[model samples]
Target: MHLLRRISTGGIALCAAAVTITACGSENSGGTTSHANGKVVLSIIVPTHTAPPTAPHAISAVRAAATAINAKGGINGKQIEIRTCNENGNPNDAVKCARQAVSDHSVAVVGSYSNSSNQLIAPLVKAGIPLVGFNAITPADYACAVCYTFDAGNTLSFAGMPAALRASGARTVTAVTLDLAAAAANVSAVEQAAKAAGLQTVPPVKVGVTSTDLAPAVQAVIGSKADAAVSVLPTEQTTAFIRAADQAKAPFTFGVVDAQVQSVLSQFRGTQGDHVLAVGAYPPLDATAAYPGLVQYKTELDAQEKTGDKDAATRDSISLRAWLSVHVVAQAAAGITGDITAASLNNGFRTAKDIDLYGIQPKWTPSAKGHVPGFDRVSNARVFFMRINNSKLVPAKPIAGLDLNTGKPF
Candidate 1:
């Protein structure tokens, strides 16, 4: 498949009729400036008003990374400027953010969190803009040729759950997921991964996205007589499921995506969270002994917090992902010697070597050759496991590797 489709400047002008395209009239607008002391702007699109309230943390991380990058003489001697647009958990707003990025002449959209990937990708792909460090919340984000996702998001966690659960002494697993399309995809991925791991899985119980009661799902899991259960719901819904499971005295261990485990810890007391596993793209922030990246992240976060940044102090999976995204953008941009345009930045990314997260995540080289089927442009297939202990997440041993195209461990 031909991934890169370059549109003529006139085509971009004509395409403006399809949507409400923001005009790029100013120097810091949609087109990159040729000024000697010009700044390279990077746009970050995140949801701040919607259900999953983690966008602020991600936004703060982007700003913090930009601050750090600028302090070190910036990328390729040009200062990095970060512009943000809140998607507000709406598809139309996501499109608007994409238009804003294009209008701003952003080198790339880095470390953004949005569920409306389909709406976001069209404008970006048309403008030859690359999206990096975004969560794979939808099929388009995974399949878009112009997008380079670092992590497989929930899919990575689901794929690694079976092995993590087996290591935790779980033999049979039951899956609980939302009735949304994305959740269904996660369930299928998990099922395949479970089979590959030599683990047995029962039929998954689907819950409504807006459902407040999770007793039925918990009852189904308890009745399944499984040794472990996996939940592919939002953070709030996952918390409800866990609480119901705890109240019913479910025997099976519980597992969720890394992002869901952050605030839900306080909901489970004592041994409630003991056997709960959280599979993530990066290691725990406290895992300083093994991953020096966590140490650097913490230091920067702490500094941001001390300077009155609200999002910096509250570290979560989304924030960490955003931080990594900014690093990836900076690392790629630092290697460019010529003009840093959208195409040039993407070329730098495609050729980047040793793209490591300081042992927090496995080294990955983002290239078309590394692309996996079904996972679209995602090249990174490594996941770290963590178990919740007394309301705290502790790192599990041995990061699991998977061939995302096959949904099996490599």
Candidate 2:
């Protein structure tokens, strides 16, 4: 009955995905690549096994990428070795991870997740290392010159929410956002986008990160009489709010989940998860489109999972971002005629244009124009929209006002 249902998640599984590889050669901590045991080395810094366990499976994602590459003769005949660092969600630890990347002489830091991008980007930037496809979280990340983001991060997601809701036939929207300053900023962005989309907005119902009882918040959404409501919340709070909304049967559609929450949308089942939209940098793992990247990722990740690596079994947005990041580096490295060292990789990424990821994401350029004011380094401003149906996420049509390239809605 809706454009949302026009596509189904079922698609033909592709045999193999193509990848780019480079002849890596030896070299330094100061913008050069150093290998251990004659292997091309890259590192991923993630907060795994932390207090809140942020992207614990990201390490496996990197590992799986390496495995897939190695299976095909290992990035131009030399096996790729991935070194992982657990930042533990601490700023100091994040800095340590960056410093470690510098000391270990990693060619690039790919697909890292950190709340401390301000701290993490410093050492890598000084060492002339590029951050590829990292989870763009903070203002520092969006503004970092050396950080290459496939996703425009939370701000763009918020900016795109209004158009997505409006496209879903919603004229009035209410916000359910966390009380933190970042969430408030996102809500503000949503308000602006809503105005541009000609959608009416209600003052957000703010919930604390620690707020467990979301029934009252759902009541507030019900009182707003909005046709749709969006959230800017952490994973735990999002789950709680959705559950509360489902229990109370709120009259508005809920949606616009971030990568972190969208990764695990399957955890929400039946009516509780239906009709919600999600925005992400990459296509969903069960994307309706027959993306070669998705097939390759599933194949590689499943291989790792078969080996009894429990972490590999945990496929979320963090890991998928990591997987895509490594592939980006590898694909870029393939074009290098000389040494595939840190300097070469960094230079390649900086000068890259129209790099395609086989339908996994939008074609990205490191130096794309029309940058958003605060998020100057967000090269790929396009956001993919997905909807939950039958307790799963599937690709949905591009909603009006959602494309950042359509105009600077952010």
Candidate 3:
């Protein structure tokens, strides 16, 4: 059976995904329609380490996507300059990066993980720097209009995860991940959604990024009378946890929420892979599915003899999330008439709508009340739901209710 997913590729992977241009990307036919405007510089920062060891892949994807935008004449001839800052999982570094990016006059910033990333960048975001994040989202209100933090393509990914658990027919959910406000927030969302669906959201277990034991967490879930357990631990720690759970023959199942689960922490696969699942966003075009616009990216790379064309189309969370971020920033830059500023891009997502770049998800049109214009609170949204299958991401449910166009939740 074919399962849909997304993956992150190195810079080379971006070129490899191009087969031919279609959709908005077709501007490549003649050449990128460069807007006649002054150059704009933007800084994109990502976590140095995390679960699934996805930072490398995510960075590669971002760099490649930037290259694609640049090839298309880059936002009315305004080239986007990407700057990278390694957090090294240290808040001090994160804060330093945030300071440099904000102080540099870049229009936007990307990649903030955990609460520390969010905290590190909060001041910058409040200073009018729009951010697109992959991991920093939590059960709380993280970022706002001046800073649109889109995780797994939308914040709804958090809500939709619990929705998926309900769909799984599971009765109890035991969640574990790194403890912080974000973890609490994630657990709260999942727990509420599960409870509302008549399923129990049990007490969550907290594991540190440096942790290697799962026995305590396992016992906690069992003690909670949970039938299944969910962890938001980093990839390496999660692997150790899963092995411990497996050895103990724990009574409950285990799964994770973030997109980082795909690469190295694919817990449920092969004969021993059952009872593990992860929530996914977009279809992994590289695996199997109809990813129409990417044909050009693929074809482009074929002519160049790139062997890793499929890399760009990786079905990982970081791939789609990072792709959305680049397109959002690129689209924001598209409107520059002359000069570039971080506030300009911040307002771009604020006033932009119907931005269906490559049909990445759905056009995330924000209105004055939120991120962009021409968007209803509910309409113009592309929310996703997916999980691990045979140790790979598979799109199972997508709760994008934006077609209503009313902007009101049903």
Best by TM-score: 2
Every model: Cα RMSD to truth: 8.6, 8.3, 10.8
Model 2 segments more than 4 A misplaced: 1-30, 179-183, 370-379, 397-402, 407-410
41-120 per-residue lDDT for model 2 (tens digits): 88899888746647768888888888888888876677888888989889899999988987786878888888777777
**Candidate 3 Cα errors over 4 Å, as ranges:** 1-38, 49-54, 111-114, 133-136, 139-142, 149-155, 176-190, 201-225, 244-253, 265-269, 285-288, 291-315, 368-383, 397-410
State the displacement of the C-alpha of residue 50, model 1, in Å, after optimal TM-score superposition: 5.7
What lDDT would each prediction earn against the true structure?
0.70, 0.69, 0.52
Model 1 residue 113 CA deviation (Å) reads: 0.7
In each prediction, how many residue pairs overlap at the backbone (N, C-alpha, C within less than 3 A)? 4, 1, 42
Residue 209's C-alpha lDDT in candidate 1? Answer: 77
Candidate 2: the clashing residue pairs are: 21-334
- Give Cα distance to truth, residue 219, candidate 3, Å: 6.8
On the 0 to 100 scale, the lDDT of residue 339 in model 2 is: 63
Poorly placed runs, candidate 1 (over 4 Å): 1-37, 178-189, 206-211, 371-373, 397-410
Question: Which residue pairs of candidate 1 clash?
Answer: 29-104, 30-103, 30-104, 30-105
TM-score of each: 0.83, 0.85, 0.69
Write down the worst ten-residue block by lDDT for model 3: 1-10
Candidate 3: lDDT over CA atoms?
A: 0.52
* Candidate structures ordered by lDDT, highest first: 1, 2, 3
Per lDDT, the best of the predicted structures is 1
Error of 3 at 129 (Å): 2.7
